[model samples]
Target: MTDEAIRTERLSKHFGRTVALEGLDLEVPRGEIFGFLGPNGAGKSTTIRLLLNLIRPTSGRAWIMGVPVGDVRAAHRHLGYVPGDVALWPQLTGMEILTYLGRLSGRVDTAYRDELIERLRLDPSLRARSYSKGNRQKVALVAAFMTRPDLLLLDEPTAGLDPLMEAEFQALTREAARRGQTVFLSSHILAEVEDVCERVGILRDGRLIEVATLADLRGLNATVYDATLDGPAPDLSDVPGVASVEPLPDGVRVTLTGPPGPLLERLAGTGLVKLRSHEPSLEEVFMTYYESPARPETGLTARLDR
Candidate 1:
C-alpha cells in the first residue's frame, strides 16, 4: 500500500462562478492525524464531498485509499465519514441508524457497536428528531467509528459536544491513529486540532495557505513575555525577532515570534522584579494569520512567518 492514504492535486470546484475550492493541493499520509482547517464557506465541506464522489470536481483529481474517487464502490469500503451537518431518519431511533449504516459498510459487529453507543452515552431508544444538536453528533460518531474502516473522514466532529464528550472524542482519535487509521478532520475549532492533529492545513478564501506541525507554529510565535521593573523598561523596539512591544501598567509586554534566547539576555541585563510568560491560545495564533493581509506564499514557509 502507498504511504499516502489521500492525495489531491490542484483540486478545483466552482458553483456558477462562485468558486467553492481553488487550486487545492493536499496529502494525508497513512496513520497520521491530518487536520483540514478552515472557517465557514472556506470549501471544507465541498472538498470532502469531492473526495467521497458525492460531487464531481470542476477541475483536478483526488484519490482515496489509492483508488480514484470517481470509482465510488472501490473507495467507499475503505472509508468511514461523518458529515458536518447530519440529516438522519427522524422517525428512527439512534440505535437503528447506527446499525443500518454499519451493516451497509458490509460489517456487523453488534457487540462493538453497542460498546461505542455505551461509551458515547447515547440513549438509542429515543427518536432522532428528539435528540439535541450534540446528541445528533454523537449518533453520527457512533455510526462512523463502529465501521472500523481503514480511513476516517470527519467534518467538525465535535460540534455542539460538551466538554466531557469532546475530551472523549479526542481520546478516540488518538486510539484510531495508534491503530493505523488515517483521519482527515475538518474543523474551525483550533484547540481541538492542536490537541489531536500531527499536521494541519489552513484554508482561506477557498485556497490552502499553510501547512505545519503545532510545534513549528509555536516556535514561529514564542510565548509572550510580561515584565515589570523598578524603573521604566528599556526600549526593545529595535530588537530582532521581536514582532511588537507594548507598554503595560506595570512595565511592558513583548510579543516574540522567533527564538527568545537573545531577547531574554537583553531583558536580564535590565534587571527585573518579576517576569511572566504566557502561551497564546490556538485562536490567538490562528487570528494572527487571518488578521494579516499578506500571503505566506509557500506552504511550510508561510506558516513559519505567521
Candidate 2:
C-alpha cells in the first residue's frame, strides 16, 4: 500500500452560521498528482485553509504526513504551497521574495534557488509591482518549487499562465511526480487536471461527491461510436453496453459505457467498413454527478482520520 501524504476525515468548518467545509474526506498518496476540482463557491479554498490550520475546523480531523494539522510548523516542513492569488511586497524583487520563502522552509541553498530561477525564466531585479499577472504567478511558483518539498499543495496554480507557460507548468508537475513528490492541485480547468492528475476528487457544496481516475471517469460516461456497414444496418437497440443507438441508411451511431473492447468485437460481426470511437470530456462525466444523487464507483478511498 502506498503511504498517504495528506488525509482528512469528516473535516468540516463553519464561519458563524455559514458552512464552509462539511465532512471533506480526502487522501493524497505519495508521489501521485491528485487533482481537487470544484466550481466557484464549492469550498476548495476553505478546505486548503483548514488543512493548513489557518482556521480551526468545526469537526473531524486533518493530517499531513501522518501528523496532526495543528502541528503546523512540523507538518509544513514537508510541504510546499502556492495560493491562487499572490500578495507580495510591491517594493521587493522576485528573488528577494523567493529567498524569504526559502528561508522559512529552514534552509536557503543558493544553487537550488538559482536553478529554479533559471527554469522559471524569472528575473531577480523586477519588483513585484512591475510584474504582470503571469509573472506574479511565476514568482509564487518559483517560491514553492524552489523548496523541493515532499508534497505540494497548489491552488489555482495556472491562474494567469499563457499556453506556453502552462505547458511549462505541466512539465514541472510531471518532474515533481517523477522524483516521488506528492501533489494536491486544485483547479477549475478540467483539461489540465485530465492531463496530469492520476486521480481526481470532485467537491460540491462543501462535500466530496466523487473520486476517480481519468480513465475510470471516461469509461463511466457514454462513448460515441460511428460505424459503416456493408449491408442494411442492423437494429442495435438491445445491444449490451450501449446506452443509445441511432441507425441510418448505410451507417449507425452508438454510445456505450465502460470499455469499447466488447462493443468493437460485436460491431465486427455487422460487416463494419469503418468505425470510430470517442470519449467524453470531464464536463460530461461531472454532469452525471449533478444529474442525480448517485456517486461514482470509487466512492471514498480515504477515511476522515478523525
Candidate 3:
C-alpha cells in the first residue's frame, strides 16, 4: 500500500478565462494532519472539489489513498469529507441523516459514532430543518469521524461551532491523528491549523506558494526581540544578523534574522532589564505571503524536518 493518502500532479482547473487553480502539485502523507491555508478565492475549495472528483479538472490528475480520483467509488472508500457549506435532507432527523450517510460509506463504527455524538453534544433526535448552523456542523463532524476512514478532508469544518465546540473539534482531530488516520484540513483559520496540523501549505492566487512546518516557516522569517532597559538602548544597526533596531519607549525593538548570539553580545551591559523573543505566528507568516507579490512560478515547496 502507498504511504501517501493524497497526491496530485500539475492539477489545473480553469473556468473559461478564470484560472481557479493552476499547475498545482502536492502530496499528503498517510497518518498526518496537513493544513491547507488561503484566503477567499485562493482555490482552497477548488482543490478539495478536484480531489473529491465533484468537478473535473481541466488538466492534471489526483489520487486518494493511491486510488485515482477518476474512480470516485473506489477512491471515496478510503476517505471522509466535510464541506464548507453543508446541506442535509430537511425532512430527515439528525440520526436519520447519519444513518443514511453511514450506510452509503459502509464503514461506520457504531460505538465510535455514539461516542462522537456524546462528545460533540449533539442532539441526534432533532430534525435537520430545526437544527441551527452549529448543530448541522456537529452532525457532519460526527459523520466524518464515525467512519474512521484513511483520510479526512475537512474544509472549514468548524464554521458555525462556538469556541468550546471548536476546541472539541481540535481535540477530535488530534485523536484521529493518533489513530493513524490522515486529515487534510483546509481552513482560513490560522490558529486552528497551527494548533493541530504538523505542516501547512499556503496557497495564493491559485498557486501553492510554500509548504513547511510552523517552526521552519518562522525560522525563515525574522525574529523580533523586545528589550526593556533601565538606561538608554545600545545601537544594534551594525550588529551582524540584526535586520532592524527600533527605539522603544523603554528600550529597543530588534528584528533579528539569524543567530541571536551577535545580537545578545551587543545588548550586553546596555542596562537590559527584560528581553523577549517573539516567534512569528502562523497568521503573521500567512499574511506575509498575501501581502507580498506572487511568485512567477509554482512548486515553492519547503519540506523541512521537525
Candidate 4:
C-alpha cells in the first residue's frame, strides 16, 4: 500500500462560471491527523464531496490508498465519512440508522458501535425527526467512528456540539490517530484544529492558500509577555526575536516573534520580580495569513507554496 492515504492531482470543479474548486493538488499521508480549514463558501464542502466521489470534479483526479476515486464503491469501502449537514431517515431511530448502515458496511463491530453511541451521549431509541441538530451530529459521529475504517472524512464534525462534547470529540480524534486511522477533518473551529491536527491545509476562494504543520504555524505567531520588574527594563530593542516593546506603569510589555531564549536571557540581565507570557491562539496565527497577501509556506515549498 502507498504511504499516502489521499492524493489529488490538480483537482478542480466548476458549475457554469462558478468555480467551486480550482487546481487543488494535495496529499494526505496515512496515519496522520490532517485538518482542512477555510471560511464559508471557500469550497471545503465541495472538495469533500469530490474526494468521496459523490460529485465528479470538472478537472483533475484523486486517489485514495492508490485506488482512484473513480471507482468510488471500492475506494469508499475503506473509509467512513461525516457530512457537515447530516440528513437521516426522519422516521428511523438512531439505532435503526446505525444498524442499516452497519449492514451495508458489512463489517461494523456492534460492540464498538454501542461504545461510540454511549461516549457521544446519544439516545438511539429516539427517532431522527425528533433529535436536535447536535444529537443528529452525534449520531453521524457515532456511525463514522464505529466502523473503524482506515480513513475518515469529517466535515465540520463539531459544528453543533457543545463545549463538553467538543472536548470528547478531540479525545476521540486522538484515539483515532493512535489507531492508525488517517483523518481528513474539515472545520472552521480553529481551536479544535489546533488541538487535534498534526498538519493543516487552508483554502481560500476555491484555491489552496497554504499548508503548514502546527509547529511551522507557531513560528509565525507572536507571543506577548507582561513583566513587573524591580529595576529598569533591560535593552531588548536589538534582540533578534523581539518584535516590540511597550513601557508600562509597572514594567515592560514585550512581543516576541520566534524563540524565547534570547528574550529570557536578556530579561535575566536585569532583576526579574514577576513575568507572564501569553501565546497566540491558532485563530490568531491563521489570521496572519488570511489578512496578509499569500506567502508560500516556507516548509511546503514544493507543493502548497508553489
Candidate 5:
C-alpha cells in the first residue's frame, strides 16, 4: 500500500451552477495529522463528502490508502468519518446505532467501543432522537474512534461540544496519531486544529490557497507583545524587527514583524515589570485570503516550508 493516506489530483466538485471545490491537488502522508481549514461555504463540508464518496466529483479523482475513492466499499473500509452535521437513526438508541455501525465496519472492538463511550460520558441508553447535539456528537466521535481505521476524517467534529468535551476530543486525536492513524481534521476553528495538526491546508472559495507547517505558520504573520514597564519605556519604534509600536494606558503594545531577537536585546535593561506575548492565530495569519479574493498576490505563501 502507498504511504499516502490521501491523495487528490485536480479534485473538482460542482452542483449545477455552483462550483463547490475546484482543481485541488493535495497529498496527506501517512501518520500525519492534516488540517483542512476554510470558512462555511468555502467547500469544507463538500470536500469531506467527496472524500467519503457520498457524492461523485464533477471532475478529477481521490484515493484513500492507494484505493480509488470510486471503489467506495474498499476505500471506506480503511476510513472512519464524522460529518460536519451528524445524523443518526431516530428510532434507534445510541447503543444500537453504534452497534449497527460497528458491525458495518466489520471490525467491532467491543471493549474499545465501551471505553470510548464511557470516556465521552455518553448515555447511550437514550434514543437517538432524544439526544442533544452534544450527545450526538459524542456518539459520532465514539463510532469513528472505536474502529481505529487507517484514516480518520473528522469534519468540524467538535461542534456542539462543551469545552470539557472539546478537550477530550483533542486528547483523543493525539492518542489516534500515537497509534499511527492519520487524521484529516477539517474545521474553521483555526486554533483547535493548530493545537494538534502538524500540517495545515487552507482552502478559500473552492481552491487550495496555502499549505504550511505549524512552525512556518508562526512566522507567516507579525507577533504582538504587550509590556508593562517600571522604568521609562524604551523607544521600540526603530528596533529592527518592530513593525509598529502603539501606546497603551498601562504600557505600550509592540508589533514585531520578523525576528524577535533585536527587540529582546533592546528591552534587556528597560526594567520590564510584566510582559505578555501572543502568537497570531492561523486565521489572523491568512486573513487576506478570507477577507478578499480580488487581491491574489498575498506573497505570504512564499515563507511556507514546501
Candidate 6:
C-alpha cells in the first residue's frame, strides 16, 4: 500500500565489538529492483537479516511495506526472502520443501510455481539430499517467487547457478518488475547487477558508501580513450576534464572525465588514424570504492559532485 517498499533509518547492528552494520539509511521505492553490492564481511547479509527481523538491530529501525520490522508477522507478510545459502530437509523431495514453504508463507500460486520450476529447469521430484547446490538454489528461488509478494529480498540469489540459469534469473527479475514487485537483490556479481538493477547501493566495512544509478556512477569515473595517430601526440594535460594523457608507442591514452567533446576537439587535427574509447565497467567503479582507503561519510559520488 505504501509507496516505499522498504525504508530504514540509521539502522545498525553489532556482534559484541564487531559492527555488522552501522548507520544505514536507505529507502527502496515500490516496483524498483535495487542492487545491494559489497564484498564479503561488508554487512550485506546483516542488513538483510535486520530487515527480515531475523536479528535485531543495535540502533534505529526499518519498515517493510509500511509495517515496522519489529512487527514481524505484519512486516513479513508483504515480502518473501531467500538467503545466500539454502538448506532443505534431506529426506524431503524438492516439491515437498516448496509445498511446506508455500504453506508457511500463507500464499502460493500453484500455476506460477510450476512455471517457475520449469523455467528454472528444476526437477522437484529429486530428494533434497541428492540435489546439487545449484538445484537447491533453484528450489529456493522458486519458493520465494511463487507468492508474488510486495517485496522479494534475495541475498546472492544466483550463487551456484550457471550462466544459462543466471540469465533466467535476470529474466525473472525483469518480469517481477513488470508486475510491479520490488526486489532487494544483494549480490557481488557486478555483471548480473548491472544487467538487471536500475539502481545500486554499494556497502563497505558495514557502511553504505554510495547509492546511485549505474549510469550516474559511470559518469563520475574517468573514461579511457586510446587513440592511434599518424603524427606526434598533442599536449592535452591542460585540457578541462582531461584527467591524464599518457603517450603510447603509436599514439596516446587519454583519460577523460566529463565529456569527450573537449578531447576530441583537441585531437581533431592530430592525424587521428584510429580511436577506441573504453567506458568504465561497473566492476571498475565498484573496485574504485572497494579498494579506496578513505571511507568518507558522503561517499565518492558526493566528492565527485564537488
- Against the reference, the lDDT scores of all candidates come to 0.82, 0.79, 0.86, 0.85, 0.83, 0.87
Off by over 4 Å in 3: 226-275, 292-306
Q: Per-residue lDDT tens digits of candidate 6, residues 227-292?
A: 999999998866776655568999998666567888898898889999998987886565445433
The candidate that wins on lDDT is: 6
Arranged by lDDT with the best first, the candidates are: 6, 3, 4, 5, 1, 2
Which pairs in model 6 have colliding backbones? none
Score candidate 1 by TM-score against the native: 0.84
Q: What would the per-residue lDDT of candidate 3 be over residues 1-306, giving only the tens digit for each residue?
A: 899999999999999999999989999999899999877778899999999999999999999989999998899889889998888899999999999999998889999999999999999998999999999999999999999999999999999999999999999999999999999999988889999999988887788888898889777767788999999888776777665566889999776667899888878778788999887676655543433223234422321211
Candidate 6 ranges beyond 4 A from true positions = 227-275, 291-306
Q: Model 3 reaches what TM-score against the true structure? A: 0.83
Candidate 5 structure quality by residue, lDDT tens digits, 1-306:
999999999999989999999999999998889999876777788888889888999999999999999899899999989876788999999999999999888897899999999889999999999998889899999999999999999999998999888989999999999999999999888778878999998877788878889789667657877888777778876777564566777777776666888887777668777889898566546553433223455322222211
lDDT for 171 in candidate 3 is: 94
Root-mean-square deviation per candidate: 4.3, 6.4, 5.1, 5.9, 5.5, 5.0
In candidate 3, how many clashes are counted?
0
Question: What's the TM-score of each model vs. the native?
Answer: 0.84, 0.79, 0.83, 0.80, 0.81, 0.83
Residue-level lDDT tens digits of model 1 in 40-99: 877888999999999999999999978999999989888988887888899999988887
* Per-residue accuracy of model 4 over 99-156 as CA lDDT, tens digit each: 9999989889899888888888999999999999999999999889889998999999
- Superior by lDDT: candidate 1 or candidate 6: 6
User: How far off is residue 142 in model 1, in Å?
Assistant: 0.6
Question: Which prediction has more favorable lDDT, 1 or 2?
Answer: 1
Model 6 alpha-carbon miss at residue 196, Å = 0.6
Off by over 4 Å in 5: 225-278, 288-295, 298-306
Per-residue C-alpha lDDT of model 2 across residues 1-306, encoded as one tens digit per residue: 338898999999888888878998888889999999877667888888887888899999999888899998888888888899988889999978887777777765678778767777778899999998878888888888777888889999988888888888899999999999988998878778888999998877778877889888777677778888888777655556665566766788766654677777777887989987777667546544544223344233222211
Candidate 6 whole-model C-alpha lDDT, 0 to 1: 0.87
